[model samples]
Target: MKLIHAINDLTATHKDLLGLSKQKTEALTNNKLDEFQALLLEEQKLIRQLEKQEKKRQEVVEAWNEEQEYSVDSLTITEILQRLDGEEQKMAEDAAITLTDTITELKRQEQLNKALLEESMKFVQLSMELVNPSIKSMNYGAASSDKLSGRSLFDSKA
Candidate 1:
């Protein structure tokens, strides 16, 4: 059960990371550099937290295994079984609760990131439109005028 919870927590963290990456990509595409930087910082913090949690979980599992190994030789088999069962049950319940909380937090962060990305994109698009009315329709083509003579290539062609 503890293993299940650890896997769930890791999965939730991965989902949050994916959402963050999506937001960052959108922000970059829309030219929201400031917001992107802020998101990146938040992502780094979350990653650190996830790493810490994973390490702690591993330690707990290792400790539990070591206790089980020692108990196997010192205690009757039935007594050891009961103890292990109790510990496993407790671990499962705790893991479930932790995983649920982690998932909820991740979802909240994802929503916030999505909103920020949308706002940034909207702001950039509006700003661009306001700054250059024809920006959306402007096309890049070969220059009609010669750089040195300032003469229209079209005129020479004609």
Candidate 2:
């Protein structure tokens, strides 16, 4: 029963993570640095809370195993579910599946966000290149100064 609740909580937290991922994509797309930073902080807090919940679930499972005189090592959720019966078993299975699906979706959203950030960075780099073209160094005759100067692509190509 407690494991069921823990899985439910895990699913909820990851759903929140998915939402944050989407919001992060929006922030990056719209160039909202302040909102992006704030969302990242909130994302960190939620991740910490999710970790604590996982630990709490682990403690509960260990306590259950100890009371049953079972070895705690190598225990899977299926083993825990086997200990349950009737509606409790169904609830546990549903919660487990939901949690797994939610985590998968969260990962997909995270990947999408990462790609967006990468593309945004590439766009910024290209923009900078257009604004301040890189200098191609070339030595002049001995009478000329040693320093080489930059030229915009348009100017040099023309």
Error of 1 at 26 (Å): 0.6
- The residue pairs found clashing in candidate 1 are none
Cα lDDT for residue 116, candidate 1: 76
Assess each prediction's global lDDT (C-alpha) against the native.
Answer: 0.67, 0.85
State, as a TM-score between 0 and 1, how close model 2 is to the true structure: 0.81
- Please count the clashing residue pairs in each candidate, in the order shown: 0, 0
For model 1, how does the per-residue alpha-carbon lDDT over 8-77 read when each residue is reduced to its tens digit? 6776776777678777767766778898899899899879978987786676566665765753323332
Off by over 4 Å in 1: 67-158
lDDT of 2 by residue, 45-96 (tens): 9999999999988887888788878876857989988888999989999999
Model 2 ranges with Cα > 4 A deviation:
137-158
The alpha-carbon deviation from the true structure for residue 137 of candidate 1, after best TM-score superposition, in angstroms, is 33
Q: Which ten residues in a row have the lowest lDDT in candidate 1?
A: 72-81
Residue 147 CA displacement from its true place in model 1, Å: 22
Error of 2 at 65 (Å): 1.4
Which residue pairs of candidate 2 clash? Answer: none
